[model samples]
Target: MAHHFTAYEVEELLPELKASLGLRRFIDEEGNEVQKVPLGPEPLMRMYITMVRARILDEWLLRLQRVGKVALHAPNVGQEAAAAGSAMALREEDWLFPSYRELAAYIARGMNEEEILDRAMANIDDPLRGSEFVVYGHRKYNIVPAPVPVGSQVPLAVGAAMAAKILGHSVVTMAIFGDGATSRADFHAGLNFAGVFRAPVVFVIQNNAWAISMPSRRQTAAKTFALKGVAYGVPGVRVDGNDVIAVYTTASEAVERARAGEGPTLLEAVTYRLGPHTTADDPDRYRPREEAKAMEKFDPIRRLGKYLKARGIISEKEEREIWSEWGERIERIVKRCYEKPPLPPSVVLENVYSEPTWNLEEQMRELEESLEVMKELGIGVE
Candidate 1:
């Protein structure tokens, strides 16, 4: 007897896999709940507010950098969804290992605005002592201090995941990096270890199309970064990074699988930076303005706004109010950041190590003496 094996037939004949992977949607862009999933209005509004705040913060930081108030700043303007979506999907106990450009993730994960701004301004109270400021850490929020070295966080994240498994904790570690970092050896090494050990980790590569001045096309010949995971025996997925729903759903599935001991997943979120690599770099030198303008049509905030308006969760007036309120709040934070004093010279030598070695102590003493001499010479250090 001959049997026809159509797509539906193949699915029916196969035993159900332990992993239950799928997408979920509560509302469409047209204001209708096509899937009829229950969702709280406040969370949706909060997501929108967070994205707007991130954009405002990026703009303000650029201006501050221009005025020499900050040493450097990396803006995560267009890739807000990749950060916010993955963050919102994680449970409170989950760990996050972020790269340099995750300001949106930090804010969404419950970082205090004042503290973040203070750190960016390199104030005396900055937790990192100014040497490191971009990657804000909140132990209460399960956020690890982001490392500045590209791709370094990958191994750290794998280590964290391994620790969670050894401790029998359900917590999963999510490491966020850019596509450029994917080309680095650390990226491959970390993924290989995680896959072999079945570590409870999710590697999120936010492909913003450029790693500084180099476009991703020039970075690698791979058809998609997600495909790189296959070599390490892990499942890889590419999603519309600008689609918050897609990112949220993909990350949610990956997290659930990791918690269930299924192993790590690699998600390549295809997105754009929408700004210069950092304050010190001029993107226009390498990236075309026309390309950025075209990418603006896929703004995650605008997409979410359309979804909210379609669902009748908010009106035009409510949306405007949300934007206006967040704008004012951001402006206030920017002013406060500028008003704060710079970090004291003492902090330069502090936190050099877990405990200061004799050599470090001597250096600190020398630094203090130099500062004193400078002060005597009428040279202000702050």
Candidate 2:
């Protein structure tokens, strides 16, 4: 029993759907401060360092994949500022529901390079234990494992925030997804529920202008992703995703608002994806190389470095030194991760059940026997 909307009702909703918010930007492409930055010298430098490491890590991930060291990766090449700025805005206790391309967010949340590499390399000690997906979840960091399905984590974040509200806790949850996810059912459900319940959560849409090979224009007819919040009775904010200061400023305000019981806000970070969707993708087929070249001027890492130089927080030489230093450290970490042992075949059933059934026990024994036989044959079964 589906009901059709009246023409009058559709007309009434059109005005609310109009794009109203302007993109919030603090710095220009040249790294000139166009607006007063909210962060001071020390914090700014720290963020810049994190952004650099994220870029370097992304570079290594691409290289490692090429050399067969890494199985697969969703590169965070061009969207460092969007991940770093918004992630750094959260408190230690706040929960982060991230996407596969949140390398910077993971780093900003204090996930060291070694830990990230371990997961990426699928080493024996990998937290997810060589799971099919390259998702991240860390109890110490209060971060949820990213779902492989697009936009699936949105409702989880909303539910967590609702629980916090009912418990009288000040925990605000933030979920980050890409532009393509805005069209998903989970995203809509999460936003509507958060709005109706006044849940303490923030929904960040990293509108990197593409959903894999699908351009954003094909994903939605809305003038802006932020405007999609209007129908759900949520406030929307548009920010420059390439500007770290701008993203941090807006995310901080949204976090504070959620902590104050003001409910969820839909934040749209407008930027470009300057790389392929994954290591298996080749952007050149669908995305114009000329367009990618043009986006280089808005490079987040270089833009931040220039801004820091202009502020006298770091010199040109210091910026180069920062890159060189982090690059060497990342090389060492990658070497260590490469040297790690592969997971044992028996670990597959370690956490599958509380008590193994008789059939399961028999299967485990068979597997053990097979491994022993292989070891006797010198087939590297151990």
Candidate 3:
């Protein structure tokens, strides 16, 4: 008998053991029941609202990027449920270490819309002040700064988890990233150390099945990203990332385990990236539009809406009203962001040091004199 099987043969024989983790769902895409509801009415309503908010914001921001109102954006279009679900599962004071594409998670963590839009506009009121681009970090809420390189935040999350253990804090650090990041050295080191020390951290791999234009097959040959945890002696599980309730339940379980000193859990969220890798990427260059369009049928937001409607927890009229409310809110914040002036050039000198160093002082002096010349020339640069 032939030992090796082709991709098609593998799919035919063990369809669930593909490059991606098998989809787990409480409710199928057709609105038919698969298992018990993962959340009650109240919690379901809350998660639904957040998912819709994220979806609306993602679409609006992508439009802004296309029109040049925003500098760059990584759309989390089909991936909202995973971020929103996992983020809501976290308790207060627990640290969130996110990759560059986790805008939905930030929103669920109570990140103010004005600040996010301000940063997107790169305005004076932006907390990062251009030092960090996009929705990178918010130390106030304990969201660690997301480094540009994939999986860079993994080690940082592990370090925080280590610190939490030493300090006797019960906080579990959650590091969320794309599946591509799993191939990085930091991902291995982070999970390995977290396993060795039994650090309280949950590794949430938002497996969108694509790393830029590269498919997940090019990234790994393993049956599932979840199994990658076994090498580090950490237990892992796969969850239906599009099912917000499932993601929340899985994440909450892992977080609780970590808090109880049971060590880390590798949570591979099987989801899809419905847009380009970033504003700079062109999905059309590689993937087919028809394939992406086919994914629309399994959209997380649409799935949740169907569930809500089936349960009578939401009506079409009520849904439309909710959307209107969000639209007004986004419009008000965006207007404020646009009306705000850019930060004064000198503000750059403030955050770099405890006190101004000689080089910085000299640079500031030169800038001031240049600004004086510009002022005399009636040139505006602020």
What is the C-alpha local distance difference test score of each model? 0.81, 0.89, 0.84
Q: What TM-score goes with each of the models?
A: 0.89, 0.92, 0.91
- Tell me the number of clashing residue pairs for each predicted model: 2, 0, 0
Model 1 lDDT tens row, 231-339: 6977787776776666777788899999999999888888899888887788788878999998887788887888888778899999999888988988887787778
Candidate number achieving the greatest lDDT relative to the actual structure: 2
| Candidate 3: segments with Cα more than 4 A from true spot | 1-22, 374-382
RMSD of each: 4.8, 3.7, 5.7
lDDT string, candidate 2, 196-248, tens digits: 99999999899998888999999898788999898898888889999999888
Once fitted onto the true fold, the runs of candidate 1 whose alpha carbons sit more than 4 angstroms away are 1-40
- Preferred candidate (lDDT higher): 1 or 3: 3
lDDT for 330 (candidate 2): 93
Error of 2 at 217 (Å): 0.6
Any idea how many clashes model 2 has?
0
Tens digits of per-residue lDDT for model 3, 215-250 = 998888888898788768787788888888788888
